[model samples]
Target: MKKFKYLFGPVPSRRFGLSLGVDLTPFKTCSFDCVFCQLGRTTNHTTERKEYVPMDGVCNELNEWLSTNGQADYITLAGSGEPTLHSRFGDVLEFIRTHTRIPAVLLTNGTLLDQPGVQEAAARAHIVKVSLSVWDTASYVNINHPHPNLKFDQLVEGLIQFRANFKGRLWMEVFLIDGMNSGPNDVKKIAQLARQINPDCIHLNTAVRPVHHDFVKPLTGEELNSLAPLFDPPAEVIPEFKTTRRPDFQTNEDTLLEMLRRRPCTSEQIAGALGLHLNEVSKYVGKLLRTNRIRKIRKDDNVYYCTVNK
Candidate 1:
């Protein structure tokens, strides 16, 4: 199969179900070099918004996928880097809206939400989820490591303004890192700011994979559960859910690798999704682990296996 340059997954997202992904920006091209970014440190850190990649190429791949009867819960504007960093991101969203029945979704860091163009573009999505990981500028610097040109206040203002007029479902994702912004008082203040945005709901998440900094740590389900009520309403703990139900397939490492490329999966998740026994999953997983083809990440109570670039 010829690979789509700008299109990637109908990956299973715990929050968004099976979602077809659109990568608008080049790898690591983002406004914020967040400490807990699983893709590691950002190489191209900038606040500049332009056509990062050819927008027509993305639309072409999307049209091809749709032509083949691509099925997914959502057509997601998320992959590799922040989608909004691309000036034509709105056009891509518009393409999905006019071209398909599947709803479009934007998973953004909320940095550019204040820009009039950005707000107008993002409003095209059926659902937009923005990030709110810090309460103050200091904490924003500590956790998100935003570009020097980007101000924490500007981030808040943009999110608030975007929410004020967005008719679609708005959601806020609070990424909690231990000893960083997960403290009770910190969450309380963060909650106050989150309420100002008035999202339809909030989804509390933690770093599930290895991060750029050692200080950033993933929270336990218990810790996340305890912190859920700190928001206006309790937040749903992000968990690895079944991506898709498969009929049956023999144990294949390539199949496992392809699945992990989409989203991290537990041994049981791999087994259940692939219709393999736990022992069979362990065998392939162990081989991949030794070769560094895949890595293990502890998410809540489960051990997840995900693809590694190296």
Candidate 2:
């Protein structure tokens, strides 16, 4: 298997099974830095749209992977940061459409959809999944901590307008924190906003995995179920991925070290990202810990392994 710089994982995904992730932006380069982000805090929080990574390199790598490995369930535009922030995002989507039979999916924060260019670029995807976690400006600031220029109402307006024009499936994800936005009043306001946006489906999610902030907590099954009815759209709790699919690449000690060198990850995340079994990941992780190449850190009751320097 080839070592790709920009492409990683035909990882099992709850929403899109066997998702091949195409990372566009650098790590933590996003407009909104949410407390529940799996990749931790935002290091570079901005709303600027530019070619962060070379467009030609991304397309070439993606084309090479597809040519060799064939298709997954979906070729997802997602990674360590926001995909839409790449200025040539539409071109990449167009390349996927022209080259492959597989569906193209965009996982975005939905902050920049207000811009006509961003909306037009996003429309190229077969399915666009956007996050709408807060109902008002106060909650938005509290949870998301978006760029200074972004307004809560503008973000909502963008979703509404984008839905009206986009022909593909529009799935809206609402991330719930235990104490932040799970109250009756907050949920009701979110439900009302969901109605106005009129997405094809509403997905209720929580911080089930390790998050940056200790205060960010996952909602239980019962809580998620109770909140599902608040939305007018067909809504359900997003389930965890339970698949036997493994990565095509070799999952060896060196591979594990390389992954950990990039960022901290749990056994499950390592398994999913590298296509290794949980048990297999544990073996490699244990060896790394013994070698003192990596150290373990606990956050939100979940353990993560990273390089000693990290």
Candidate 3:
């Protein structure tokens, strides 16, 4: 198979199925520095939108991949950063819609959803999923740590506006933390607010992978079940990660997973052991990390990877 710079996975997503991810922005370029982000801290925290990765490069890679008749459940616009930060993301979605039968999905933080341009571009996707975990500005700032320019009221207004106009499925996710936003008062307030926007489905999620801060904690299955009934339509918990690859889609990814299943290893250690280049190993490792198949841990100076159940 040809190596791709702009595309990764047929990642077995618990929500979106076999999702082929499109990366439009540089790493960690986002509007929020979320406390529970699995990819770690945001290096560039801003709402600035630009052609971070040129549209031509992304389209060229997509054209090549599509020409081979690659299959996926959804062509996802997401990666290490907020994809909407790329000014030309709608054009990419247009390309997918024009050329293929596969549906598109947009995963966004909902901070920029207030902007008309962002909302317009976001509508191109068949299903749009936005994050809303807090009830007020104080909780939003505490958990999401959004850009200074973003406001909670504007975000809610934008979401309500988008829901009125959007013809596609709009899914809202509320990420609950142990002591931060999972209490009866907080959850009840958030549930009340969620009813106003009125998404097609509400998904309750908790951190299952390694997070940016040690204090960030997850809610247990029982605890999550207890909180589900608070929403107007009642929320469903997000499931654990899984991937469905094609029959011809055998790669070093399988070997790496098997290797990590026995013991944890760093990226460098993985490359050396697998007889593969460090750069080549990163894509597969990232896919594994994103899907929650394997997790990273910091030990002294080195970070290591092991299966999530470990």
Candidate 4:
């Protein structure tokens, strides 16, 4: 079986089920070094939107996939890097719409929304899910650690602009880090932003998977649920993280090695790719390292796997 470097998931989503994720920017390239980011640290942090990957190449690949699979719940633009960082984001959205009837969604950190070009690009998406980690500037700096050039005021303005222009649903995602954005004041500020943006829904999230910062912890469900009522109706905490059980979807050691050749993956990432249990994937990865099919790289005590050819 062939594994894709760019396309991942049809994984479980709290908002959209079985989302087929498309990576627009290069791996681990992003504007923020968020405390709760699932992908770990940002190796390259910049606000500039460049042609990180050949837009036409990615568009062509996406067309082929959509043409074959037809549609899933949502065709999401998000991957290891921030999607808006791709200068040709508008073209990508247009390309997807031209080829498929599936609703296109752009999942972004919302830092770039203030840019006229970014706003123009986002106008084409069927849904926009923007991340707002904290309400105040200090909290913003502490929690998200966004690009030095990004301003919280501008971010808030841009989010409002998106709400004004986008006809589709606007879903706001708030990631609460313990003792940081989970307090009463933080919750109040977030609630104010929610009312201002007036998104279709607000999703309260805690770090469930391993993250870039060792200090970040997932808030208790009870803690998250407490913040739900502050926003307007339809605003609530994420229900639960659910995994699908499909026995037919399976990957072997050889298949896993092939995937590592293209991208470095943690045990969790490998499991996500294969749709297998983490413990099961960890056992296979451990075995492969002993055989020297893969090499291990340690960053901040976290292990990542990459292919090593003999």
Candidate 5:
């Protein structure tokens, strides 16, 4: 698979299988600076959604892939940052529908859901997954670290409203960062809110990959299992969902190494970015590091190897 600056994964989604993903916003442009974000930190944190990248350029590239490749289970609008920040997302969604039969899925942090136009744009998507990490405003600020312009009350209300207006399935993904949003009191409050919203499914997930902060760690299987009953419809561990084919996309070892230059990634993220098998990715990365194409750094006792030179 050839790498495109505009698109990245059909990364293994615990929910959507071999899902084809589209990056609507430019890199690192997001509405939140989550403590558990895999992409590191946010460079831009405003809610404004202009055509950050030319819409026509992205559409053309997407059409090319859709027309040539086998159909994916879902066409997900997600990438290095929040997908909802793309102001022309409605146009992008419409463009995707015109070109492919795959269902559209929108992955969002749920900060912008308060905007009517944002909600309207999402209506075209077959599924919308919103993140509900913390229950109260203080916890939301401490953990998700949304744009200063966004309000926690408005975000929750917007998600609730989106559930009402959109006819598609709503899946709420709760990434429980230990000691931050995973305590009994926090889970209980979040469950109350989930009950009010009534989403179709509640995905209880823990950090499986390296994240921005050193403090983040995925909850033990036992911890997640015990906490599943808090959400309205009740939550389930992400792995409970059936696995599908790996996502189809293009990426070279060089591209994978380039992405790794800035941050550390697990084998899964590297494979998803490059469209390679995990074993294959390990082989290339090992080869590169040995040849001085990259270097390895360890954080929290975890080794992250990356390309240090072009």
Candidate 6:
């Protein structure tokens, strides 16, 4: 298979099946350094929007991937960081729409939607999934740890305004932590806000991957079920998607290490990319870890292996 600079996967996704991810920002560049982020803490937390990745380069890669391996459920604008931070986000969505029939999806942190340009760009996607984890400034700071300039109220207002203008499917994700935003008062406040925004669906998510903070933990099935009815739009807990079939590509230590040298990836991501089984990927990862060629880091609730230097 041909290697792509900006394209990452046709990886199995629980929400959007077999998603082909398009990464628009540099690794870990985001507006919010959420405690439950799967890509680890945001290394460059900022609200500034720029052409972080060359738009032409991304389109070129997309063209190449479509020509060779066009099989994907959704061409997702999500990977290591928030996709909305890229200044040409709408243009990229346009490019995808012009070139292919596959529907585009934008996964955002919902902080930048206050900007007219950001909201306009985001409105182009077929599905816009915004994350609203907290209802107040204190909880926002505690959970998302956004850039200094962003306010919780501004984010909520943006969602409400965006929904008023957007014609596509709008899905809101609310990430819950055990002691942070799981109380009745917090859930009720979030429910009220959800009603105001009127998203098509409200997804209840908890930390299911390895988290940067040790205190963050996944809610049990019962706990998730109990919280589902708190919202007016009726929330559903995001379920884990599992697969037993092995992927098509062959993976070895050198190939896995070479890929890790580029960016850290979870065993599941590696498995999907290399077309190998998760257990098979783990064998090579274990060997790499023992040899000190790669190190393990916890983000969200998944363990990602990366080059030691990274």
Best-matching candidate per TM-score: 3
Q: Which ten residues in a row have the lowest lDDT in candidate 2?
A: 242-251
lDDT of 3 by residue, 1-310 (tens): 5657788765656678677888887777899999977666799999999999989999999888999988888999988789999998889988988989899999988777788998899899899999889999999999999999999999899999988888999999999999999998999999998999999999998876556576888888889999999998999987754433544334567888899999999877886796643433555675677677898788886668998987
Model 4 Cα lDDT, one tens digit per residue, 1-310: 1345566655555677656777887757888988877666788998888988888788777877766764468888887689999999888888878888878899999889988889989988999999887887898888888889988898999999878888888888888888877887878888888889888888887765545455777787788887778777645877643332332223365678778998888887887887654423544564565456787777777778888862
Output the number of the lDDT-best candidate: 2
- lDDT per model vs. reference: 0.81, 0.84, 0.83, 0.77, 0.76, 0.82
What is the alpha-carbon lDDT of model 1 when measured against the actual structure? 0.81
Candidate 5 on 27-108: residue-level lDDT in tens?
5889899988766678888788788778888888887777667466888888757877787888888887777788888888
Residues 1-310, candidate 2, lDDT per residue (tens digit)?
A: 5657777666667778777788899876999989888676799999989999999999999989987966689999988689999999999999999999899999999999999999999999999999998998999999999999999999999999999999999999999999999997899899899999998999998866555577887788889999898888647898756433554323466788898899898877987897654423544565466457888799787788899987
- In candidate 4, position 90 carries an lDDT of 83
**What is candidate 1's lDDT per residue for 1-310, written digit by digit as tens?**
2457777655546788777778887777899889887655688998888999998888889989988888889988886688998999999999999999999999999999889989999999999999899988999998888999899899999999999999999988999988888889999999999888899999898866445456778787899999999888777787655423432222266789999999998776886797653433554575566567899777675567789972
Error of 5 at 245 (Å): 4.7
Residue 297 displacement (Å), model 6 = 9.4
Global Cα lDDT for candidate 6: 0.82
Which candidate, 2 or 6, would have the higher lDDT against the true structure? 2
Candidate 5 accuracy as lDDT? 0.76
Give the TM-score of each candidate. 0.81, 0.83, 0.86, 0.81, 0.81, 0.82
The CA-based lDDT of model 4 is what? 0.77
Error of 1 at 204 (Å): 0.7
Q: How many clashes show up per model?
A: 0, 1, 2, 0, 3, 8
